[model samples]
Target: MKPVFFLREALRALKRNAIPSFAAMATVLVTVLVLGVFIPVVQATTGAANEVRGKVIADVYLKTDAQQKDVDRVERVLKSEPMIKSVEFISKDAAYKTERERNPKAYELLGSNPLPDTFRITPGNPDDIAKIKDALAPEAAGGGRTVIDPAIDEVRNREEDTNKILAVTGVVKITMALLAGLLGVASMLLIANTIRLSLYARRREVEVMKLVGATDWFIRWPFVLEGVIVGLVGGVLAIALLAVVKIAVVDPLAADFALIAAPDTIDFPLLIGLLLVAAVAVSSLGSGLSLRKFLRV
Candidate 1:
């Protein structure tokens, strides 16, 4: 049979069973929308976590009365450690200046500069944070009271906060994946049912074709084409809706949430392509599965 014949038959079947066709398409639309929206958000969240994780560093605060020699000694020790990637010393005055710049009005209430001299230690990796901290702390590595670095009054690391963020991102990804799977299955079943109903409605036509010696493959092509059309249309609709949401809702909010450093990570073109491919696959599979019973003749 010619391609035109299959297209004509598929179009006629779609028109004859308008309700089921619409239902099937709607199911696909909802499934694709849910998948499209969350997948990008999850990706952006993960990217932000990675960016922060790369910059993870330890802050070593010094005693108020600590002098230049103390700073140099701590700096030398930090440089010697294999876990340490880089160290930058910040004087009390410089720290105070940064605070003032960050919140100009808040510092007006303070009588004197209370910020301490500090050394910011960037670790080779976030996992190496604990080792680097203990090495530079006042306590010796063996737990004896011997001070390893006298100038180090306290040590601070944001490893816990980073871990929590990563954990939450992981949970979000897993939840989205499960939800996408459920919706995908649901869409497939709905499409299959729609195709089954359409075929059943035209049982008489199929019987006539079988009597005239029409092969099963010839009988199946139109239904498969119909399924492909339904899927492609649904995917297109979902893509349009997602595009609107991205432009009106997501794009506008990205700037406002820039402080978290998570925006601009979602690749729109790639996402749309994947959604279209998934839609076609699910729809076609559903149609093929439903056609088995009707093809027995």
Candidate 2:
């Protein structure tokens, strides 16, 4: 009939099946809580991984006797490459000064600057490091020594260190993505099971309505509304709990730890909105699907 009738029916069903309703609500709360905590953690972790990837760079050492024109030519070539993000040139004097600052005693014994002019190259993607290096100095056709420009002394990209960083960050990203997917599937199944229980508890009522020529939609509305109410209540409760945790634990810890206070995290209001929407949508879908089998009667 009217929407009010369905709403009333849903409320009555909840009151009649208090224990089942509570269980279903509790399930939703737990699922939402896990997701709420997970969203920001994933963001923070991904941000950190990207920061590490940014450090993967290639250093091109120019010949000690190379002229300014040679250095300019090398810079132009590097800048024209599509995969290269940036190229920074450090003169021999600057390099020597920096080294001397790090260790005054080591440089004091030297009569002149020993370091060569260098080009620091950052790639658009960390994985393209080897490609960039190979492009600069390709190996001979028969696997002989790498060929290079006459004005370049060497190209050192620290392949081993880059590989280690890339491997760790790649694994971290893949693991986080897989874990998020598993959690999503688990949440949906848990909600479905809880909704199924509620449906089983009122199977006879559904069958009676079906037998009395009531339309399926007419019988389904109340149960669907019931699910929505449960989900809304559960999501609200979860948000409250999360707020308490954030204020009581996270805020204090963040104040002391720069890592915890990273700017890459999702905004709290946006995260809360997402969790609430996810809860309602999942609950409604679970209830509707669980009610389908009973409607066939």
- Estimated TM-score for each candidate: 0.61, 0.91
Cα lDDT for residue 296, model 1? Answer: 72
Candidate 2 TM-score versus the reference? 0.91
> Which ten residues in a row are the worst by lDDT in model 1?
138-147
| Model number with the top TM-score | 2
* Per-residue lDDT of candidate 1, residues 1-297 (tens digit): 599998998899889889888887887788788878767766666566556566667798888888898888878887998998888889999999999999888898885898999889888876677777766664656775343676777888776785665466557657756876776677666656766776677777877788899988788888788888988999999999999988998778876875475645547999899999988888877777777776676
After superposition, the stretches of candidate 1 with alpha carbons farther than 4 Å from their true spots are 55-173, 180-208, 255-259
The CA lDDT at 246 in model 1 is 86
Candidate 2: Cα lDDT at 65: 97
Number of clashing pairs per prediction, in order: 0, 0
lDDT of 1 at 83: 91
